[model samples]
Target: MTDESPAFPPPPPPMGAPAAPPAATPALPWYRRRWWKFPAWAWLTAAVVLIAAGAAGGAKKDEDNASADTTVESVADAATTDAPPTATDAPTTEAATTTTVAPTTTRATTTTRATTTTTTSPPTTAAPQPIVFSGRGDDVVNLPDTDLMVATISHSGRSNFVIWALGFDLQETDLLVNVIGGYSGRVPVNMNADTMSLQVEADGDWTI
Candidate 1:
């Protein structure tokens, strides 16, 4: 007998044997498979892309934050450098000047003058001259001297008449003389020592 495997194969797997697993469905490539299905490479590739994107974003954000920090620091430094300096107390200087004045002197001069005086002598007056006369008669008579005359009567004549005659003649000489006579007509007459001699005359028994 030729042992020929029965035509169709051994009897189909017994019903009890776990039915051959349903033919495994062919795995589709990642691009052609349903969206829910994924291969290891596909998941790995997606995970790598996401990780790279997150890293890139984080780097950009850090750079931005760094630039902001640099800008703030630069602004603060600039403000410090540009601020004005503080004031200090310093002393000021001043100059002093002096002036002088001169004094003036004056001199005075004196002058003297002389005066003259003249003395004059008083005028001399002439001396009086002496008078002399002699005569005798009973009637009135006259006796003459240099510039004077004397007259007398013995007949009781008024004395005024004798004085009038002497005064009238002697006025020019400016001399004084005195005479004496008797009380009644009969008595004799006499003359003062300083007088010119008196002349006498007799009229009847009386001397004039």
Candidate 2:
């Protein structure tokens, strides 16, 4: 016999086993693939992007609110603006009142019991310069000290009001006004005030 060995038949497969290999999983379409089958890192990245977008929107909303607040404050300031009420500011118009005294005249009587009549004239006096203060609404205006002052009040509105002229101790001076509507009048300030000011309660524009 030659040195070649004879081949035997293969052994039988295990009982109940299938003859073919298992089938491969079916592939999904491109659109449906990433819906639920995405990896852990991909889902985390998507969540991060959503959170960043929300934060950016919130920040923009806060900035818009701040800008609105600033606009409101600016409008409020303009509505109640007040003019300068310093005591030193004076009007440019000048008014001078001049008085002349005539010489005494002596006349002889023509009729009987002739007598000479002599008339004497009083001394002339000059009027003081006027200090003017003007503004709208209610305010306390400071004034410079003066030996004598005439307060000429002029109101444009028809509402009745009163003004109190305070002395250096904040007490009511002799000068005051009580009237209604648009009025133009003057009051002599008798009481002297080292620190003088006017307390006004009125409506509409006024000048003094």
Candidate with best TM-score: 2
Candidate 1 residue 30 C-alpha distance from true site, Å: 7.2
User: What RMSD does each model have against the real structure?
Assistant: 33.6, 50.4
Poorly placed runs, candidate 2 (over 4 Å): 1-127, 192-195
| Candidate with maximal lDDT | 2
Q: Positional deviation of 179 in candidate 2, in angstroms?
A: 1.2
Residue pairs in collision within model 1 = 137-201, 137-202, 138-201, 138-202, 138-203, 153-208, 154-207, 154-208, 201-208
Candidate 1 TM-score, C-alpha based:
0.27
> What TM-score, computed on C-alpha atoms, does each candidate reach?
0.27, 0.36
Model 2: per-residue Cα lDDT over 150-186, one tens digit each: 7888988778656887777877775477777787898
